[model samples]
Target: MTRATFEIEITPNETPLLPGVGRFDFQKVWEGDMQGRSVGLMLSAGDPASGTAGYVCMEVFEGTVDGKLGTLAFQQLGTMDGGNQGLRYIIVPGSGTGELEGAIGVLNLTVDEGTGEHSILLEMSSDH
Candidate 1:
């Protein structure tokens, strides 16, 4: 497998869906080792005080993956319960385009709690 990392900037707009449910639409710009942009939609529910909120997100990334040009789609599912948090992110099968066609991988996104710096790590099949 091959791994590459990229720094990301995300802009999100929250839209209320109901009393405790809402959606967030976001646009992401990525730089560093990978240059690209992505658009994402996310749905979240619950209150901060209760600490039982959860979210699911879908994002389409169009750009370079480790200097190789292509487009990819990924999904994220996460939940925060009390002081515990869990998240899962993965590349959508057959969603790679151009040079990334037929590529299979897992994607991980991380943020620094103090700095708020976001980054993505893509672990791809070596066959690509």
Candidate 2:
């Protein structure tokens, strides 16, 4: 397993998808073992302002993981309620290309409340 950390920037899309849903586009700059950038789209529902909400996102990451260069896709699901939060990030099956062919992994994310900083911890492996 490999662990990597990253920082992210999220921008809200002006175009509304639904009455109560929000759309966003995000970019991540990864560091540590995995070095590169990723772009993703997110759809969210409910109200985070009231401390309850859910979101789903799909990201395409282009980078070098442990010196192997390739691209991988990830699916992310997350929810937050009050002081509790749950998140899961999984590599999309058969979505690996180049040196990362047949890659699989789970990623965990963390946010620092005091600094409003976001980071990720990726546990990744490949069939190749």
Q: Give me the overall lDDT of model 2.
A: 0.88
TM match of model 2 to true structure = 0.90
Q: Compute the lDDT of residue 52 as modeled in candidate 2.
A: 98
lDDT of 2 by residue, 1-128 (tens): 55677788899998968998999999999887888899999999998989899999999999998889999999999999997999888999899999999999888877788997666677887766
Best by TM-score: 2
Which tens-of-lDDT digit does each residue in 1-128 have in candidate 1?
Answer: 33444454444565556776777777777777667888888888777578888988999989887788999888899999988989899888888889888877777778878987777677776345
Give, for candidate 2, the lowest lDDT window spanning 10 residues: 118-127
Question: TM-scores of all models?
Answer: 0.82, 0.90
User: Candidates' lDDT values, in order?
Assistant: 0.77, 0.88
Candidate of highest lDDT: 2
Candidate 2, residue 109: the lDDT equals 74
